[model samples]
Target: MPEKFDIHQPDDRFFKSAMSDPEVVKAYLQHFYPKIAAIAYLSSLKLENSVSLRPSLKRFEADVIYRCRFQGEADGRFYFCLLFEHKSKPDKYVAVQVGLYIMELLSSMVKKQGRELEPVLPLIFYNGKEKWMPQTLSELFQEHPHFIALEPYIPNFRFLFQDATRLSPAALLELVGVLLLERTQPNFVLIEAR
Candidate 1:
């Protein structure tokens, strides 16, 4: 529970640290990512053990994971994995990195948890200075928009993207208690850990 608007290190690092709080994570998704919060059992949300997810290592940038179950499933045996990634910049190759990470996670899960494959939902949080338009995996591979024929051949999956740069102050008001989200300068956001 630090009490300072720290700006010494990178903002993305601070974001990752703030996300370590389950309350912050829940509030973030519940307010920012309602589509997922609607069907997900937020009460049962729990972070997975930390693991390296660097781009070179076939992982992602701050690949925070959470295990969740559907809200109202009769037999809550299956789990829906939420793969959270935060990017400090606009990365064109992010879809590729996320794809590889998903595959790696599923393979590891099958070995540990029987033959059932848990569904993974990739959620990317971009708090960069510039605006980033996130694209699907297939959209990145398709050089031209007319390449509809290749749609069936390549892997096409959509991800949940939250661009903090585009978020208004009102949208961020609820998260103030867990972590104070403030804009100290034109493009930089200062996060004060609670």
Candidate 2:
């Protein structure tokens, strides 16, 4: 028999734990995806209590969902979901998959039939070998003359995508620039690079 090395590393558990904290998530938004972060009042961010349709997601406890109102407007609420997917290569149907998750979340949120649904922004952090720039719903289809008719009703919304493969050393510096971690995690050695 060949020798096998077994090392227990904090995979999903660490991810779920770290992402559960609003501050950590806030720091991530503030640091990398500032434009999306600006859309919300980050102070009012609260985690929503919702179950997932997938068993894998349930076992991993990877659902990091936050609900908050717009920066200035308090009447309506917005949700931004953080999904951490580590794929070796970019999947073409990633947008469809993300869309399904967002739709599932939306379905779970609706209590009444006539009530309006709050906007939910799906944020994908793609850490993989190849670069991925997420496409909007409209972009997924062939943009021929015949396709022009369907464009208006395509329900276009872009995913807040971050491709880790394309990140430079500067981006790492950018990531840790605003993150001053108080919690000690073996996985994170956040050094504030000027």
Candidate 3:
């Protein structure tokens, strides 16, 4: 067996390259995206080319986007958008950022096919030293004395959050090994070759 490579810096390039691998992505989804996994099979995943919806936004430049079809659902497909944050501290506006990305993805999908927008699973892969605390969009909102009344009007969305810093060593090694292999040879086949 090949030795596992350690990902010292989990930057945008690192994530984009690592997550491009179907195996790595499959493992990631299996572990982090339970809701999607329950509905869709890993074999059904097909990677799509990522587009930059907002070129002017500097922070949105390095996000990775993937589109795939569900195993049983023949008529519909969904997108998976991953945003990597390598900063030591978490961004307070992560919710808003993810929301914008989701809207952009929906708009692109609608324009491409002239059909109803499909679902988008926005995910944040944080590898910072600190533990990620904010799990939902509502958590980022400012608390007010009468916030209950305004809650209904707020545009809210939840993202699957994964903190690599929290993963066990064995699990991390598996993920990293797949990532390194995939990065080295994108066309590297798995089960199909066997």
Candidate 4:
């Protein structure tokens, strides 16, 4: 395994490389969250195989969003927003970052076509050093004055995290080992090998 504090910035080439190898992505996600592997596979919609990690923004930035079409049952095209944030310790700022990304995605879409569009799902794949549990209304209210209670409206399918920091050492090793294995590529290999 590589060093723990790998603050090295992965370039566009790296992104393109992984995008080319759908197996790498599937393995990475499976390692990140084995419990939700099935759901992740379903939601993947065979997207990595069809699309590239083409960033819309000129400036290289965090929360890079990628667009892809679903080649699965429905064949619906969707945008997968990938937010990369690395931290030495756990914090509550993840919500703010994800919130900003979601806002940016909708705002950009509306601005492009000059019209309102339906909500797009934002699946955040977190490779950070913390476990992200979305802040609740009560928790947020605690920080502010109690004069008016803020009823937070958190929508479903808004955000999801691939929590690496929270997983046990054994689990983490198992996941990484799975990801590193060349033969155990994507779903087919997973099904057959398992």
Model-by-model lDDT, in order? Answer: 0.74, 0.63, 0.64, 0.45
Give candidate 2 regions above 4 Å deviation. 1-15, 54-62, 72-88, 112-116, 143-145, 176-182, 185-194
Per-residue C-alpha lDDT of model 1 across residues 37-119, encoded as one tens digit per residue: 89888878888864755446653333588888788874656678888888878999888878877887787777774546889
Q: How many backbone clashes does candidate 2 have?
A: 0
Residue clash pairs of candidate 1: 53-60
Among these predictions, the greatest TM-score belongs to 1
Best model per lDDT? 1
The TM-score values for the models, in the order shown, are 0.76, 0.68, 0.72, 0.51
Q: Taking the tens digit of each residue's C-alpha lDDT, what string does model 4 give over 82-172? A: 4333333445655565555556656566676544443444444434544566553345446566424444443323355445567787777
Instruction: Give the Cα error of residue 152 in candidate 1, in Å.
Output: 0.7
Please give the range of 10 consecutive residues that has the lowest summed lDDT in model 2: 54-63
Q: Count the backbone clashes (under 3 Å) in each candidate.
A: 1, 0, 0, 0
Clash pairs detected, candidate 4: none
| Cα deviation of 15, candidate 2, in Å | 4.1
For model 2, residues 165-185, the per-residue Cα lDDT tens digits are: 677888856544433352445
